[model samples]
Target: MDAVKQHQQEEYQQFIKDKIPKPNLLRNAVAAFVVGGLICDVGQFISNFGQSYFNLNKDDTSAFTAIVLVFLGALLTGLGIYDQIGRFAGAGSVVPITGFANSIVSPAMEFKREGYVLGVGAKMFIIAGPVLVYGFSSSVALGILYLLFSI
Candidate 1:
């Protein structure tokens, strides 16, 4: 019985290995570029639509579009649809601010189940905190330098 079980396990492993596709570096690089470009293209499309429909200037249109995408991404993340889309689109789904919102909320939601203090609360900002910190710090530093240089 033990020998049969071991043989079956080995065969199953072999079958899985054989069925899996081998990685191709060129294919992966091309796929990543295409998906990333597509994501940016979609964002541009949204921005353009907002600009035309609402008569918003470039900055306002961009802000509005970003807000809309972020809201939609968060909603999709809540509905559990974003994960499937992420899997399908790979870098395409991950290249936007929407993806950032999803990344921040998804892990937080999972950690919430582990308890608030140590789990959800602690881990909630694990992904996004660094981004926020860097963004804020860089902006502040740039502003200070600009002020000093302008004087």
Candidate 2:
């Protein structure tokens, strides 16, 4: 009985290994690099637009650039385009402000059919809530520490 069970387990393990798909690391890395660079390039363009056309100050230019990127990210996510990019580019599409926008919008879009109040509003923060909470909490903590140490 013990031998039979061992043989079955070995066979199952072999089957799992054979069925698992192997990733092309070089290809994935190249794709991520290209996609991530392109995203950053778009951000730079927006910043330049703000600076050159609107004559925005450095701080305002940065704020305008961030807003535009976030809007584009939300729009792409709403249109179901960001997901496709994410599938192809993996971490490339997910390490920027745009990705943060997608994180917030994606869940809201998913829950839209359920009801705006319960679904969209509540579930909207499913992924981003923890990130926001931790981010804000840490910032506050850091600010307090800085104040205490500086005094």
TM of each candidate vs. truth: 0.69, 0.82
TM-score of 2: 0.82
lDDT of 2: 0.95
**lDDT tens per residue, model 1, 1-151:** 6999999999999989978888776766676677667767777888989988889997898798888878878898999998987876676677678889898889888898789899988898898888889999999999999999999
Evaluated at residue 1, the lDDT of candidate 1 is 64
Task: Enumerate residue pairs that collide in model 2.
Answer: none
Alpha-carbon runs more than 4 Å astray in model 1 = 1-23, 88-91, 114-121
Tens digits of per-residue lDDT for model 2 on 25-104? 98999999999999999999999999999999999999999999999999999899999999999889998889999999
Residue 83, candidate 2: Cα error in Å is: 0.7
State the displacement of the C-alpha of residue 81, model 2, in Å, after optimal TM-score superposition.
Answer: 1.1
Number of the top-ranking candidate, with TM-score as the measure: 2
Error of 1 at 81 (Å): 3.4
Model 1 scores a TM of 0.69
Per-residue lDDT of 122 in model 1: 88
